[model samples]
Target: MKTKHYLTLADAEILMNRAVELSAQRSFNMSISIVDEAGALLLMKRMDGATPLTAHLSLEKAKCSAMSRRPSKFYEDIIRNGQMGFLTLESVTGMLEGGEPIMYEGQLIGAMGVSGAKAFEDAEIAQKAIHDFFQQIS
Candidate 1:
Protein backbone atom coordinates (compact mmCIF):
# COMPACT_ATOMS: atom_id res chain seq x y z
CA MET A 1 0.00 0.00 0.00
CA LYS A 2 1.13 3.53 -0.77
CA THR A 3 1.20 6.20 1.83
CA LYS A 4 -0.98 9.24 1.21
CA HIS A 5 -0.39 12.75 2.50
CA TYR A 6 -3.34 14.48 4.02
CA LEU A 7 -4.01 17.60 6.05
CA THR A 8 -4.51 17.42 9.77
CA LEU A 9 -6.45 19.71 12.08
CA ALA A 10 -3.21 21.42 13.05
CA ASP A 11 -2.47 22.16 9.43
CA ALA A 12 -5.94 23.56 8.97
CA GLU A 13 -5.44 25.81 11.98
CA ILE A 14 -2.18 27.13 10.58
CA LEU A 15 -3.83 28.04 7.31
CA MET A 16 -6.80 29.63 9.02
CA ASN A 17 -4.60 31.72 11.33
CA ARG A 18 -2.48 32.99 8.50
CA ALA A 19 -5.53 33.88 6.45
CA VAL A 20 -7.05 35.69 9.38
CA GLU A 21 -3.89 37.74 9.92
CA LEU A 22 -3.68 38.68 6.27
CA SER A 23 -7.34 39.60 6.10
CA ALA A 24 -7.02 41.83 9.15
CA GLN A 25 -3.96 43.57 7.75
CA ARG A 26 -5.93 44.30 4.60
CA SER A 27 -8.97 45.46 6.54
CA PHE A 28 -11.02 42.68 4.99
CA ASN A 29 -13.61 41.02 7.16
CA MET A 30 -14.20 37.86 5.26
CA SER A 31 -15.10 34.23 5.73
CA ILE A 32 -12.45 31.57 5.40
CA SER A 33 -12.63 27.81 5.00
CA ILE A 34 -10.09 25.01 5.06
CA VAL A 35 -10.86 21.62 3.58
CA ASP A 36 -9.10 18.30 3.32
CA GLU A 37 -8.01 16.69 0.07
CA ALA A 38 -11.33 14.91 -0.23
CA GLY A 39 -13.20 18.22 0.06
CA ALA A 40 -14.25 17.70 3.63
CA LEU A 41 -14.34 20.83 5.73
CA LEU A 42 -11.65 20.95 8.39
CA LEU A 43 -12.24 24.46 9.67
CA MET A 44 -14.35 27.50 8.87
CA LYS A 45 -14.50 31.08 10.11
CA ARG A 46 -16.72 34.03 9.42
CA MET A 47 -15.17 37.24 10.63
CA ASP A 48 -17.10 40.04 12.19
CA GLY A 49 -18.84 42.17 9.52
CA ALA A 50 -18.82 39.33 7.03
CA THR A 51 -22.16 38.26 5.70
CA PRO A 52 -23.58 34.89 6.63
CA LEU A 53 -23.64 33.94 2.98
CA THR A 54 -19.89 34.33 2.89
CA ALA A 55 -19.47 31.49 5.32
CA HIS A 56 -21.29 29.11 3.01
CA LEU A 57 -19.54 30.43 -0.07
CA SER A 58 -16.10 30.04 1.48
CA LEU A 59 -16.73 26.41 2.25
CA GLU A 60 -17.99 25.74 -1.24
CA LYS A 61 -14.92 27.39 -2.72
CA ALA A 62 -12.61 25.27 -0.61
CA LYS A 63 -14.48 22.15 -1.64
CA CYS A 64 -14.21 23.13 -5.27
CA SER A 65 -10.47 23.57 -5.03
CA ALA A 66 -9.97 20.35 -3.16
CA MET A 67 -12.12 18.26 -5.46
CA SER A 68 -10.78 19.76 -8.64
CA ARG A 69 -7.17 19.74 -7.47
CA ARG A 70 -6.83 23.24 -8.84
CA PRO A 71 -7.61 26.80 -7.90
CA SER A 72 -11.31 27.55 -8.04
CA LYS A 73 -10.44 30.41 -10.34
CA PHE A 74 -9.58 27.90 -13.01
CA TYR A 75 -13.22 27.03 -13.44
CA GLU A 76 -14.16 30.68 -13.32
CA ASP A 77 -11.73 31.43 -16.10
CA ILE A 78 -13.07 28.64 -18.19
CA ILE A 79 -16.58 29.84 -17.71
CA ARG A 80 -15.55 33.36 -18.58
CA ASN A 81 -14.00 32.07 -21.74
CA GLY A 82 -17.44 30.85 -22.83
CA GLN A 83 -17.26 27.37 -21.43
CA MET A 84 -20.75 27.35 -20.00
CA GLY A 85 -20.63 23.60 -19.70
CA PHE A 86 -18.38 23.96 -16.69
CA LEU A 87 -21.23 25.46 -14.79
CA THR A 88 -23.05 22.18 -15.06
CA LEU A 89 -20.45 20.43 -12.95
CA GLU A 90 -22.29 19.25 -9.85
CA SER A 91 -19.21 18.71 -7.76
CA VAL A 92 -18.05 22.32 -7.87
CA THR A 93 -20.46 24.94 -6.65
CA GLY A 94 -18.01 27.76 -6.04
CA MET A 95 -16.35 28.78 -9.30
CA LEU A 96 -15.95 32.48 -8.97
CA GLU A 97 -12.48 32.61 -7.33
CA GLY A 98 -10.71 32.76 -3.95
CA GLY A 99 -10.13 29.01 -3.67
CA GLU A 100 -6.58 27.69 -3.70
CA PRO A 101 -5.39 24.12 -3.45
CA ILE A 102 -2.68 23.37 -0.92
CA MET A 103 0.15 21.33 -2.31
CA TYR A 104 3.24 20.01 -0.55
CA GLU A 105 6.10 18.38 -2.41
CA GLY A 106 3.80 18.12 -5.41
CA GLN A 107 1.15 16.34 -3.42
CA LEU A 108 -2.28 17.85 -2.99
CA ILE A 109 -2.94 18.13 0.73
CA GLY A 110 -5.89 20.43 1.10
CA ALA A 111 -7.28 23.84 0.13
CA MET A 112 -8.16 27.29 1.46
CA GLY A 113 -11.00 29.61 0.46
CA VAL A 114 -11.82 33.17 1.38
CA SER A 115 -14.74 35.44 0.63
CA GLY A 116 -16.20 38.94 1.27
CA ALA A 117 -13.58 40.99 -0.52
CA LYS A 118 -13.38 41.37 -4.29
CA ALA A 119 -12.80 38.15 -6.16
CA PHE A 120 -9.15 38.88 -6.85
CA GLU A 121 -8.61 40.09 -3.31
CA ASP A 122 -10.11 36.91 -1.95
CA ALA A 123 -7.84 34.84 -4.14
CA GLU A 124 -4.86 36.90 -3.03
CA ILE A 125 -5.64 36.33 0.62
CA ALA A 126 -5.94 32.58 0.14
CA GLN A 127 -2.71 32.47 -1.86
CA LYS A 128 -0.83 34.47 0.75
CA ALA A 129 -2.04 32.28 3.57
CA ILE A 130 -1.00 29.14 1.74
CA HIS A 131 2.35 30.70 0.96
CA ASP A 132 2.91 31.57 4.62
CA PHE A 133 1.81 28.10 5.64
CA PHE A 134 4.42 26.56 3.39
CA GLN A 135 7.03 28.95 4.72
CA GLN A 136 6.33 27.86 8.27
CA ILE A 137 6.45 24.19 7.39
CA SER A 138 9.61 24.57 5.37
Candidate 2:
Protein backbone atom coordinates (compact mmCIF):
# COMPACT_ATOMS: atom_id res chain seq x y z
CA MET A 1 0.00 0.00 0.00
CA LYS A 2 1.12 3.53 -0.58
CA THR A 3 2.34 5.48 2.43
CA LYS A 4 0.11 8.01 4.22
CA HIS A 5 1.13 11.56 5.13
CA TYR A 6 4.05 13.05 3.19
CA LEU A 7 5.96 13.66 6.37
CA THR A 8 8.44 10.98 7.49
CA LEU A 9 11.07 10.46 10.14
CA ALA A 10 13.74 11.28 7.58
CA ASP A 11 11.89 14.44 6.60
CA ALA A 12 11.76 15.49 10.21
CA GLU A 13 15.46 14.89 10.65
CA ILE A 14 16.37 16.80 7.51
CA LEU A 15 14.14 19.70 8.46
CA MET A 16 15.60 19.94 11.93
CA ASN A 17 19.16 19.67 10.69
CA ARG A 18 18.58 22.27 7.98
CA ALA A 19 17.16 24.66 10.53
CA VAL A 20 20.30 24.24 12.59
CA GLU A 21 22.55 24.75 9.59
CA LEU A 22 20.73 27.92 8.50
CA SER A 23 20.73 29.27 12.01
CA ALA A 24 24.50 28.77 12.30
CA GLN A 25 25.27 30.16 8.86
CA ARG A 26 23.27 33.31 9.58
CA SER A 27 25.19 33.79 12.81
CA PHE A 28 21.87 34.39 14.49
CA ASN A 29 21.55 31.78 17.15
CA MET A 30 17.90 30.88 17.59
CA SER A 31 15.40 28.54 19.06
CA ILE A 32 13.79 26.44 16.38
CA SER A 33 10.55 24.53 16.78
CA ILE A 34 8.49 22.21 14.63
CA VAL A 35 4.92 21.01 14.96
CA ASP A 36 2.86 18.33 13.32
CA GLU A 37 -0.37 18.81 11.43
CA ALA A 38 -2.28 18.60 14.65
CA GLY A 39 -0.08 21.31 16.13
CA ALA A 40 1.83 18.95 18.35
CA LEU A 41 5.51 19.46 18.99
CA LEU A 42 7.82 17.38 16.84
CA LEU A 43 11.32 18.61 17.65
CA MET A 44 12.92 21.78 18.95
CA LYS A 45 16.43 23.17 19.22
CA ARG A 46 17.83 26.12 21.18
CA MET A 47 21.14 27.49 20.04
CA ASP A 48 23.80 28.72 22.45
CA GLY A 49 22.82 32.39 22.24
CA ALA A 50 19.06 32.04 21.89
CA THR A 51 17.06 34.09 24.35
CA PRO A 52 14.54 32.75 26.84
CA LEU A 53 11.74 34.70 25.10
CA THR A 54 12.60 32.91 21.88
CA ALA A 55 11.51 29.62 23.40
CA HIS A 56 7.87 30.60 23.80
CA LEU A 57 7.77 32.60 20.58
CA SER A 58 9.23 29.72 18.63
CA LEU A 59 6.57 27.35 19.83
CA GLU A 60 3.83 29.91 19.32
CA LYS A 61 4.88 30.56 15.75
CA ALA A 62 5.16 26.86 14.96
CA LYS A 63 1.74 26.33 16.41
CA CYS A 64 0.38 29.28 14.48
CA SER A 65 1.80 28.05 11.22
CA ALA A 66 0.48 24.55 11.71
CA MET A 67 -2.91 25.85 12.64
CA SER A 68 -3.13 28.34 9.78
CA ARG A 69 -1.42 26.11 7.23
CA ARG A 70 0.15 29.28 5.82
CA PRO A 71 3.39 31.17 6.22
CA SER A 72 3.17 33.19 9.40
CA LYS A 73 5.03 36.01 7.69
CA PHE A 74 2.00 36.64 5.57
CA TYR A 75 0.31 37.87 8.66
CA GLU A 76 3.21 40.24 9.15
CA ASP A 77 2.30 41.82 5.86
CA ILE A 78 -1.32 42.09 6.84
CA ILE A 79 -0.35 43.75 10.07
CA ARG A 80 2.14 46.03 8.37
CA ASN A 81 -0.63 47.41 6.22
CA GLY A 82 -2.73 48.02 9.33
CA GLN A 83 -5.37 45.46 8.55
CA MET A 84 -7.41 45.51 11.73
CA GLY A 85 -9.69 42.82 10.43
CA PHE A 86 -6.77 40.43 10.26
CA LEU A 87 -5.53 41.63 13.58
CA THR A 88 -8.85 40.93 15.22
CA LEU A 89 -8.95 37.58 13.50
CA GLU A 90 -5.89 36.77 15.51
CA SER A 91 -8.24 36.34 18.43
CA VAL A 92 -9.83 33.50 16.52
CA THR A 93 -6.89 32.27 14.44
CA GLY A 94 -3.52 30.93 15.46
CA MET A 95 -1.72 33.39 13.19
CA LEU A 96 1.63 34.78 14.33
CA GLU A 97 5.22 35.36 13.19
CA GLY A 98 8.21 33.00 12.82
CA GLY A 99 6.22 29.98 11.68
CA GLU A 100 5.33 28.44 8.32
CA PRO A 101 3.43 25.35 7.31
CA ILE A 102 5.25 22.43 5.74
CA MET A 103 3.61 21.22 2.57
CA TYR A 104 3.94 18.18 0.29
CA GLU A 105 1.68 17.08 -2.52
CA GLY A 106 -0.05 20.41 -1.91
CA GLN A 107 -1.01 19.26 1.53
CA LEU A 108 0.27 20.63 4.78
CA ILE A 109 1.89 18.08 7.05
CA GLY A 110 3.61 20.30 9.57
CA ALA A 111 5.05 23.71 10.34
CA MET A 112 8.39 25.21 11.37
CA GLY A 113 9.35 28.22 13.50
CA VAL A 114 12.58 29.96 14.42
CA SER A 115 13.17 32.86 16.80
CA GLY A 116 16.07 35.02 18.13
CA ALA A 117 16.82 37.28 15.22
CA LYS A 118 14.37 39.77 13.74
CA ALA A 119 11.05 38.33 12.65
CA PHE A 120 11.97 38.58 9.00
CA GLU A 121 15.30 36.85 9.50
CA ASP A 122 13.67 34.09 11.49
CA ALA A 123 11.07 33.73 8.76
CA GLU A 124 13.82 33.53 6.14
CA ILE A 125 15.47 30.61 7.89
CA ALA A 126 12.12 28.87 8.24
CA GLN A 127 11.47 29.47 4.53
CA LYS A 128 14.86 27.94 3.65
CA ALA A 129 14.05 24.95 5.77
CA ILE A 130 10.74 24.49 3.96
CA HIS A 131 12.38 24.86 0.57
CA ASP A 132 15.03 22.36 1.57
CA PHE A 133 12.31 19.96 2.68
CA PHE A 134 10.75 19.88 -0.76
CA GLN A 135 14.18 19.49 -2.30
CA GLN A 136 14.98 16.59 -0.02
CA ILE A 137 11.93 14.73 -1.18
CA SER A 138 12.12 15.70 -4.82
Candidate 3:
Protein backbone atom coordinates (compact mmCIF):
# COMPACT_ATOMS: atom_id res chain seq x y z
CA MET A 1 0.00 0.00 0.00
CA LYS A 2 1.16 3.57 -0.70
CA THR A 3 0.41 6.65 1.30
CA LYS A 4 -1.08 9.25 -1.00
CA HIS A 5 0.56 12.68 -0.96
CA TYR A 6 -0.02 16.02 -2.62
CA LEU A 7 -0.95 19.48 -1.51
CA THR A 8 -4.64 19.99 -1.96
CA LEU A 9 -5.86 23.20 -3.56
CA ALA A 10 -7.40 24.42 -0.29
CA ASP A 11 -4.15 23.88 1.55
CA ALA A 12 -2.21 25.54 -1.22
CA GLU A 13 -4.48 28.53 -1.09
CA ILE A 14 -4.16 28.71 2.66
CA LEU A 15 -0.41 28.80 2.26
CA MET A 16 -0.62 31.36 -0.51
CA ASN A 17 -2.80 33.65 1.60
CA ARG A 18 -0.24 33.58 4.36
CA ALA A 19 2.44 34.39 1.82
CA VAL A 20 0.42 37.31 0.56
CA GLU A 21 0.01 38.64 4.06
CA LEU A 22 3.72 38.44 4.72
CA SER A 23 4.67 40.09 1.45
CA ALA A 24 2.14 42.79 2.07
CA GLN A 25 3.71 43.53 5.43
CA ARG A 26 6.99 44.07 3.64
CA SER A 27 5.33 45.95 0.79
CA PHE A 28 6.41 43.44 -1.82
CA ASN A 29 4.11 42.40 -4.59
CA MET A 30 4.86 38.75 -5.26
CA SER A 31 4.26 35.87 -7.60
CA ILE A 32 3.49 32.64 -5.76
CA SER A 33 2.82 29.07 -6.91
CA ILE A 34 2.28 25.58 -5.55
CA VAL A 35 2.87 22.36 -7.49
CA ASP A 36 1.82 18.80 -6.70
CA GLU A 37 3.99 15.76 -6.12
CA ALA A 38 4.52 15.35 -9.84
CA GLY A 39 5.56 19.00 -10.17
CA ALA A 40 2.32 19.80 -11.89
CA LEU A 41 0.68 23.17 -11.32
CA LEU A 42 -1.81 23.38 -8.45
CA LEU A 43 -2.26 26.98 -7.44
CA MET A 44 -0.71 30.32 -8.35
CA LYS A 45 -1.20 33.98 -7.64
CA ARG A 46 0.36 37.34 -8.44
CA MET A 47 0.02 40.24 -6.08
CA ASP A 48 -1.23 43.62 -7.19
CA GLY A 49 2.10 44.98 -8.37
CA ALA A 50 3.87 41.76 -9.26
CA THR A 51 5.24 41.71 -12.79
CA PRO A 52 3.70 39.32 -15.29
CA LEU A 53 6.97 37.57 -15.95
CA THR A 54 7.29 36.53 -12.34
CA ALA A 55 4.40 34.11 -12.80
CA HIS A 56 6.25 32.01 -15.35
CA LEU A 57 9.68 32.08 -13.73
CA SER A 58 8.35 31.36 -10.26
CA LEU A 59 6.54 28.21 -11.39
CA GLU A 60 9.58 26.95 -13.28
CA LYS A 61 11.84 27.50 -10.29
CA ALA A 62 9.48 25.51 -8.08
CA LYS A 63 9.38 22.73 -10.65
CA CYS A 64 13.17 22.67 -10.72
CA SER A 65 13.32 22.40 -6.95
CA ALA A 66 10.77 19.58 -6.90
CA MET A 67 12.65 17.75 -9.63
CA SER A 68 15.98 18.07 -7.83
CA ARG A 69 14.47 17.53 -4.36
CA ARG A 70 16.81 20.22 -3.04
CA PRO A 71 16.58 23.91 -2.43
CA SER A 72 17.29 25.90 -5.55
CA LYS A 73 19.96 27.91 -3.71
CA PHE A 74 22.16 24.84 -3.41
CA TYR A 75 22.45 24.77 -7.17
CA GLU A 76 23.17 28.46 -7.05
CA ASP A 77 26.02 27.71 -4.66
CA ILE A 78 27.42 25.01 -6.92
CA ILE A 79 27.50 27.40 -9.86
CA ARG A 80 28.91 30.27 -7.83
CA ASN A 81 31.67 27.96 -6.67
CA GLY A 82 32.42 27.29 -10.33
CA GLN A 83 31.69 23.57 -10.25
CA MET A 84 32.10 21.92 -13.66
CA GLY A 85 28.66 20.29 -13.44
CA PHE A 86 27.05 23.71 -13.51
CA LEU A 87 28.40 24.46 -16.96
CA THR A 88 25.54 22.55 -18.52
CA LEU A 89 23.11 23.42 -15.72
CA GLU A 90 22.08 26.83 -16.95
CA SER A 91 18.72 25.33 -17.86
CA VAL A 92 18.24 24.32 -14.22
CA THR A 93 19.59 27.45 -12.62
CA GLY A 94 16.71 29.36 -11.15
CA MET A 95 18.83 29.05 -8.07
CA LEU A 96 17.49 32.53 -7.53
CA GLU A 97 15.84 31.31 -4.30
CA GLY A 98 12.16 31.21 -3.34
CA GLY A 99 11.58 27.57 -4.24
CA GLU A 100 11.08 24.73 -1.72
CA PRO A 101 9.83 21.17 -1.68
CA ILE A 102 6.67 20.47 0.26
CA MET A 103 7.03 17.55 2.58
CA TYR A 104 4.60 15.23 4.34
CA GLU A 105 5.60 12.30 6.57
CA GLY A 106 9.25 12.84 5.71
CA GLN A 107 8.61 12.61 1.99
CA LEU A 108 8.56 15.13 -0.78
CA ILE A 109 4.94 15.82 -1.65
CA GLY A 110 5.23 18.94 -3.77
CA ALA A 111 6.84 22.40 -3.88
CA MET A 112 6.17 26.10 -3.61
CA GLY A 113 7.60 29.07 -5.54
CA VAL A 114 7.66 32.78 -5.04
CA SER A 115 9.08 35.73 -6.98
CA GLY A 116 8.68 39.51 -7.50
CA ALA A 117 11.25 40.45 -4.89
CA LYS A 118 14.85 39.73 -3.95
CA ALA A 119 15.88 36.07 -4.00
CA PHE A 120 16.17 35.96 -0.25
CA GLU A 121 12.80 37.60 0.22
CA ASP A 122 11.18 35.11 -2.12
CA ALA A 123 12.78 32.27 -0.19
CA GLU A 124 11.60 33.69 3.09
CA ILE A 125 8.05 33.94 1.86
CA ALA A 126 8.01 30.36 0.64
CA GLN A 127 9.47 29.15 3.93
CA LYS A 128 6.92 31.00 5.98
CA ALA A 129 4.06 29.60 3.97
CA ILE A 130 5.34 26.07 4.34
CA HIS A 131 5.83 26.45 8.05
CA ASP A 132 2.45 27.95 8.68
CA PHE A 133 0.54 25.55 6.50
CA PHE A 134 2.11 22.38 7.82
CA GLN A 135 1.50 23.42 11.36
CA GLN A 136 -2.15 22.78 10.64
CA ILE A 137 -1.63 19.70 8.51
CA SER A 138 -0.68 17.20 11.19
Candidate 4:
Protein backbone atom coordinates (compact mmCIF):
# COMPACT_ATOMS: atom_id res chain seq x y z
CA MET A 1 0.00 0.00 0.00
CA LYS A 2 1.09 3.58 -0.66
CA THR A 3 0.49 6.56 1.56
CA LYS A 4 -0.85 9.79 0.13
CA HIS A 5 -1.50 13.31 1.34
CA TYR A 6 -5.02 14.50 1.98
CA LEU A 7 -6.74 17.53 3.41
CA THR A 8 -7.39 17.33 7.11
CA LEU A 9 -10.31 19.09 8.78
CA ALA A 10 -7.96 21.75 10.09
CA ASP A 11 -6.61 22.37 6.60
CA ALA A 12 -10.09 22.55 5.13
CA GLU A 13 -11.16 25.12 7.72
CA ILE A 14 -8.11 27.26 7.06
CA LEU A 15 -8.75 27.15 3.31
CA MET A 16 -12.41 27.98 3.78
CA ASN A 17 -11.58 30.96 6.01
CA ARG A 18 -9.04 32.34 3.55
CA ALA A 19 -11.51 32.08 0.69
CA VAL A 20 -14.14 33.91 2.72
CA GLU A 21 -11.70 36.64 3.72
CA LEU A 22 -10.67 37.22 0.12
CA SER A 23 -14.27 37.48 -1.01
CA ALA A 24 -15.09 39.89 1.79
CA GLN A 25 -12.03 41.94 1.05
CA ARG A 26 -13.22 42.42 -2.50
CA SER A 27 -16.72 43.18 -1.33
CA PHE A 28 -18.05 40.17 -3.22
CA ASN A 29 -20.38 37.86 -1.41
CA MET A 30 -19.46 34.34 -2.43
CA SER A 31 -20.11 30.71 -1.78
CA ILE A 32 -17.01 28.66 -1.17
CA SER A 33 -16.63 24.90 -1.16
CA ILE A 34 -13.77 22.60 -0.28
CA VAL A 35 -13.54 18.95 -1.18
CA ASP A 36 -11.24 16.07 -0.45
CA GLU A 37 -9.36 14.11 -3.09
CA ALA A 38 -12.34 11.89 -3.61
CA GLY A 39 -14.51 14.90 -4.34
CA ALA A 40 -16.35 14.57 -1.08
CA LEU A 41 -17.29 17.87 0.54
CA LEU A 42 -15.40 18.81 3.65
CA LEU A 43 -16.55 22.39 4.08
CA MET A 44 -18.95 24.80 2.46
CA LYS A 45 -20.00 28.39 3.20
CA ARG A 46 -22.32 30.82 1.52
CA MET A 47 -21.60 34.37 2.52
CA ASP A 48 -24.25 37.01 3.11
CA GLY A 49 -25.90 38.41 -0.03
CA ALA A 50 -24.68 35.56 -2.16
CA THR A 51 -27.21 34.09 -4.54
CA PRO A 52 -28.85 30.88 -3.37
CA LEU A 53 -27.70 28.94 -6.41
CA THR A 54 -24.11 29.84 -5.65
CA ALA A 55 -24.05 27.42 -2.77
CA HIS A 56 -24.76 24.43 -4.96
CA LEU A 57 -22.61 25.64 -7.83
CA SER A 58 -19.63 26.03 -5.56
CA LEU A 59 -19.90 22.48 -4.34
CA GLU A 60 -20.14 21.07 -7.83
CA LYS A 61 -17.15 23.13 -8.88
CA ALA A 62 -15.03 21.78 -6.05
CA LYS A 63 -16.05 18.24 -6.81
CA CYS A 64 -15.32 18.61 -10.50
CA SER A 65 -11.89 20.03 -9.75
CA ALA A 66 -11.00 17.30 -7.32
CA MET A 67 -12.22 14.51 -9.54
CA SER A 68 -10.73 15.92 -12.71
CA ARG A 69 -7.45 16.96 -11.09
CA ARG A 70 -7.48 20.16 -13.11
CA PRO A 71 -8.85 23.65 -12.86
CA SER A 72 -12.43 23.89 -14.14
CA LYS A 73 -11.26 26.42 -16.67
CA PHE A 74 -9.39 23.69 -18.45
CA TYR A 75 -12.66 22.07 -19.37
CA GLU A 76 -14.18 25.42 -20.26
CA ASP A 77 -11.38 26.00 -22.68
CA ILE A 78 -11.97 22.62 -24.25
CA ILE A 79 -15.62 23.41 -24.80
CA ARG A 80 -14.69 26.78 -26.20
CA ASN A 81 -12.22 25.18 -28.54
CA GLY A 82 -15.07 23.60 -30.53
CA GLN A 83 -15.61 20.63 -28.32
CA MET A 84 -18.96 21.85 -27.13
CA GLY A 85 -19.68 18.16 -26.76
CA PHE A 86 -17.66 18.36 -23.61
CA LEU A 87 -20.77 19.66 -21.92
CA THR A 88 -22.60 16.42 -22.47
CA LEU A 89 -19.91 14.47 -20.70
CA GLU A 90 -21.84 13.80 -17.49
CA SER A 91 -18.70 12.98 -15.57
CA VAL A 92 -18.04 16.70 -15.01
CA THR A 93 -19.89 19.95 -14.44
CA GLY A 94 -19.13 23.43 -13.13
CA MET A 95 -17.09 23.96 -16.30
CA LEU A 96 -17.42 27.69 -16.42
CA GLU A 97 -14.60 28.51 -13.98
CA GLY A 98 -13.66 28.93 -10.31
CA GLY A 99 -12.52 25.39 -9.59
CA GLU A 100 -8.95 24.75 -8.45
CA PRO A 101 -7.15 21.69 -7.16
CA ILE A 102 -4.89 22.00 -4.17
CA MET A 103 -1.40 20.63 -4.78
CA TYR A 104 1.31 20.11 -2.19
CA GLU A 105 4.68 18.54 -2.82
CA GLY A 106 3.42 17.44 -6.21
CA GLN A 107 0.40 15.70 -4.71
CA LEU A 108 -3.21 16.62 -5.19
CA ILE A 109 -4.56 17.01 -1.67
CA GLY A 110 -7.93 18.58 -2.32
CA ALA A 111 -9.79 21.25 -4.26
CA MET A 112 -11.69 24.51 -3.80
CA GLY A 113 -14.44 26.34 -5.66
CA VAL A 114 -16.05 29.77 -5.42
CA SER A 115 -19.03 31.50 -6.96
CA GLY A 116 -21.10 34.71 -6.74
CA ALA A 117 -19.16 37.25 -8.81
CA LYS A 118 -17.63 37.06 -12.27
CA ALA A 119 -16.07 33.77 -13.28
CA PHE A 120 -12.57 35.17 -13.08
CA GLU A 121 -13.27 36.74 -9.74
CA ASP A 122 -14.53 33.46 -8.41
CA ALA A 123 -11.43 31.72 -9.69
CA GLU A 124 -9.24 34.38 -8.12
CA ILE A 125 -10.74 33.79 -4.71
CA ALA A 126 -10.27 30.05 -5.00
CA GLN A 127 -6.68 30.55 -6.13
CA LYS A 128 -6.00 32.72 -3.12
CA ALA A 129 -7.22 30.03 -0.78
CA ILE A 130 -5.11 27.38 -2.51
CA HIS A 131 -2.06 29.57 -2.13
CA ASP A 132 -2.72 30.42 1.48
CA PHE A 133 -3.55 26.81 2.24
CA PHE A 134 -0.15 25.65 1.07
CA GLN A 135 1.50 28.31 3.18
CA GLN A 136 -0.33 27.13 6.27
CA ILE A 137 0.57 23.51 5.67
CA SER A 138 4.13 24.17 4.69
lDDT by candidate, in order shown = 0.90, 0.80, 0.83, 0.87
Q: Report the lDDT tens digits of candidate 3 across residue range 27-117.
A: 9988988888677999989889899989986897788788878777777777778773625444754565888888888888888889999
Per-residue lDDT of 3-99 in model 1, one digit per residue for the tens? 7888999989988999999999999999999999998999999999999989988998999899989999998888888867634554445887999
TM-score of each: 0.93, 0.83, 0.90, 0.92
Cα lDDT tens digits for candidate 4, 3-95: 798889998999998899989999999999999988999999999999998998898888889988999989878877887663454544577
Model 4 compared with the native: what TM-score? 0.92
The parts of candidate 2 lying over 4 Å away from their true place are 1-6, 85-95
What C-alpha lDDT does candidate 1 achieve relative to the native structure? 0.90
Best by lDDT: 1
By summed lDDT, which 10 consecutive residues of candidate 2 come out lowest?
Answer: 86-95
Per-residue C-alpha lDDT of model 2 across residues 24-124, encoded as one tens digit per residue: 99798899888888778888888898888787778878888888788887766776677746345534233456788988777789998888898888888
Tally clashes: model 3.
0
Q: Candidate 3: misplaced stretches above 4 Å?
A: 84-93
